[model samples]
Target: MSAGEELRARLAVALTRARDRSAALTECVDETELVAQHSPLMSPLVWDLAHIGNQEELWLVRDVGGREPVRRDIDELYDAFRHPRAARPALPLLDPDEARGYVAQVRDKVWEVLDRAPLRGRRLERDGFAFAMIAQHEQQHDETMLATHQLRSGPAVLTAPPPPSPSWPPAVGAEVVVPAGEFTMGTSTDPWALDNERPAHRVALPAFAIDAAPVTNGQFLEFLDDGGYRRPELWSARGWEHRQSATLAAPQFWERDGAGNWWRRVFGVLAPLPPASPVVHVSYFEAQAYARWAGRRLPTEAEWEKAARWDPRTGESRRFPWGEGEPDSGHANLGQRHLEPAAVGAYPAGRSPLGVGQLIGDVWEWTSSDFQPYPGFSAFPYREYSEVFFGGDYKVLRGGSFGTDPVACRGTFRNWDLPIRRQIFAGFRCARDVVGA
Candidate 1:
């Protein structure tokens, strides 16, 4: 059909997907699925739904109908964006059905504006983009809510870790080394690169070897068996302090029974640790501790990217090691696979130029560098994109994890979490400098 029809069709499809996602999220009732964060606007499913719904109206309604903005009271009712530490925006507190109706109303208006007569308004572009962004944002929260539902709703004490996939992109324990070379680091082009990863520049490298595969639960267990966590020397001073205060004997989700066998959770299922599965749900601190115990170190963001880059010599700065392709189970353990982290090195076809496997999924590999912006970096459409953290003491992690969206996993895509957060699906791979005489 016509260009307008195509745009309408696109918007219509997005709303339909959003509706389906929203319906699934409806199951997250009364904190069964979604544990409301201390701040309501952050994790309360109610706050998320209301917030996204209001966003649609704010962005699309004026264009579709001659509608004035949402009422000020309504804005206050679900305004979670303004204050970071504020309590969850007090919603109208409608029952689920009523809330769904309100959301549907906004979605319907959006479809109408997108589908009907061609028009050019700055607000159209502005709200259209916002609508899309919020819709995607809500979908992400939808997944988390599902896990939260299972986490809090059931008396489900996790007894074991999830089962691992049998094979990965490469054989277990494969290794690769690259000769010294200079390469550009970070994103040089403007195509959805995060600000912290932008204003890309060049970096020099020396010859070094990297693990072809991520560290496995089985391997990490060796460190644990050797009292890795107990040894103060195996940990950074901060890490040692954290370990002492936390008193964790194993990975965050891992536990051993009288049998001394490992078990943990996958998505929602519990099973034993797959010997070959990349260790997951560990935090940056734990990863660092493990790397020290294993006589290795985590890769720098620059070093990690250099080896993980698609074209070793001259590949485009990609969102993933596998290039621009969106993630799927076959390519990576992202999206709603219900499958947990796969066996390490399973997707050889998706391996990095240096034969580093599972660089985009299985787990978010820890990086050695602290999170910081690049040269000439500028915030994009949203100021919160990067300016908030000029010198924020956050560490950078790369290679999206099992729960990540494919779109969220790019070479230039960076994620940050306090080192102490071990609940997220994070793990680490090691890098070492070859000894120089």
Candidate 2:
């Protein structure tokens, strides 16, 4: 195949992968469940179903293909900025069957555009960026719908095999030192990287230590045992206030039996907590308090990126933690292959040059840095995607989660959310400064 043909083939596969996953997520439930707002934080599954199609129609059929809008009447109904998740149910939305049909129609138009549209020239078409962007957007919403499934109170409807056992356990309290120096952060060459992660720049830093693997459920249980939540000193003032108001005790979805043993609900299946797996469904406040109790801090975005991407041996950065290679099942727990995080040290192949394991998948790791633009950032296509969300109100998260699709994730991939959001799959690893290095 020619180079352009190859690009089109990859884009088609990415789009198909995203759509298949979306079907799996939304097809398991009945229409009532699809229309019900499982949580105030998440849109109804049907809304997401239609929203995905709407976005595809807007970007691919209308914008890129230069075609008349497909169902422009419903554009405002699906516009995320126009309505909050809590209010979506009240608005007239396409039913499950209608939504499925609508997305299928939109996709038909997309494939027509993909077959003939020049993959080069215009900025949107350059390197097939627009197609990739839409695919990523759909996968992101699929993840959101997966979260809604997790929040739904029902019998277990989704199932997957457990993640593989680690070849060897990650040592207790293991950390890898990133020596003081400069390393390139973000990316300028990544054709599909979103605006927030653009314009690669060098970042200088002093010596510091980061966890070799993400903190596991066993370690976090220790924090809970020691009154980690009750002690005010262990939390920031704002964190403490939110903790008290939200009645934060354990990670969301956790339940304590009369025997006082902790169990958690995963996709509607109640099971005992796995000590070795990285803890998920935690908020930034909870992670921060846990770090404080452990006498460490959350890694900043730059610190996390450097640890995940920098190659000390060669004085350069790698595309992924292990190297410049696309992720596979053995490399990381991604793409909903497993519904939960694998045990730390499970994917030794995925470790960075500095030996930071599980950095690419499992859980979205919270960093100390607030969501902000990198130096020389500029919005393309639209500003609502990233520019509107840049501020201190949101905290930066690096690395993708088990729910994150590969097309939407990379070392330079940036995810952010309000600090108190715990419904999403999020976790953290601790870091400490080295005074003299």
Candidate 3:
């Protein structure tokens, strides 16, 4: 196929895959569940359903193709900035059937734009960036909707085969030493990378050791047994205040049974905590407190990126932990193929050059850095996407979780949220400075 033909084919696949995943997420739940706000932190599933279609229409049909608006009157209704999640159910949202039809109509228009456009000249059209952006946007909402599913009160509706078993026995608390060096931090050439992850720059650091894998439930249980949450010294002043005010005892969705064993609810199914799996649904404060209790610290964002992407053998960075190749079923627990995190060391093939395992998926590893811009960062197309959110208020998270799709998750992809927020599938690992390095 010609270059243009190849690009079109890839964009078509990405867009179709996103839509398929969106359908699975919404269809599994009934209309009442879709319309209900599962949590204050998440929009109603129906809102996400229509919002994805609206964003596709706005960015592709109007901005890129310069076509007439599909439904101009509803723009403000679906505007995420205008309506918060808690307020969205009160708005005049398209019901499930209507949302399905609207998205289908918008997608039909998108296909026509794809068929006729030259995919060149304009920056958004170059390399089909706008199309890819829409696909990623839809996939992001798919993840958010999945989170809502976890929050809703219902009996097990979502299910997936458990993640693959580890090929070799995992060294539970093993650490990998990342030697001191300068390595490229972000991407300048990745065609689909968002603005915040642009303009690759050098970040120098001294030697440090990061966990071979994310901290697991068993390890976290040790902290709980030792009164990690009650010991104010283990938490930051702000974290302690939030912990007390919120009565944060364990990860969200977790409770102790009368037998004293911990069980957690996953997508409405209550099960015993899988000790070997990386702990999920944790806030930065919880992760940080655990790190402090362990006498370690969360790795800086640069440190986490360096460990995930840096290739000491070549003194260069890779597009992913495993290399330049895109993720697959064998690589990591991504794309909702599995509903929860895999046992640590499950994907040996996904390990980085430094032998750090499961860095790409399983759980979003919390880092100790604030969301910030790269040295030469400049917003493209718009500022609301990344520029508006940059600051110390948000903590940077590296790696994607089991709920993330491959199109939206990568080594350099950045996800940030308020440090105390915990509804998302997040987890963490610890790092300690190499003494006398």
Reference-based lDDT, each prediction: 0.66, 0.94, 0.92
Which prediction has the highest lDDT against the true structure? 2
For 169-248, candidate 2 gives per-residue lDDT tens digits of 77987999999999999999989998899989999999999999999999999999999989999999999999999999
Candidate 2: stretches off by over 4 Å: none
Model 3 per-residue lDDT at 236 = 96
What global local distance difference test value does model 3 have? 0.92
User: Please, what is the TM-score per model?
Assistant: 0.82, 0.99, 0.99
Clashes of 2: 0
Model 3 agreement with the true structure over 72-135: per-residue lDDT tens digits: 9889999998987888989999999999999999999999999988889898888899999999
What value of lDDT does candidate 2 attain over all alpha carbons? 0.94
lDDT of 2 at 322: 85
Q: How many residue pairs clash in each candidate?
A: 19, 0, 0
The residue ranges of model 3 lying beyond 4 angstroms of the native Cα positions read none
Candidate 2, run of 10 with poorest lDDT: 167-176
Model 2 TM-score (2 dp): 0.99
Ranked candidates, highest TM-score first: 2, 3, 1
Candidate 1 overall lDDT versus native: 0.66
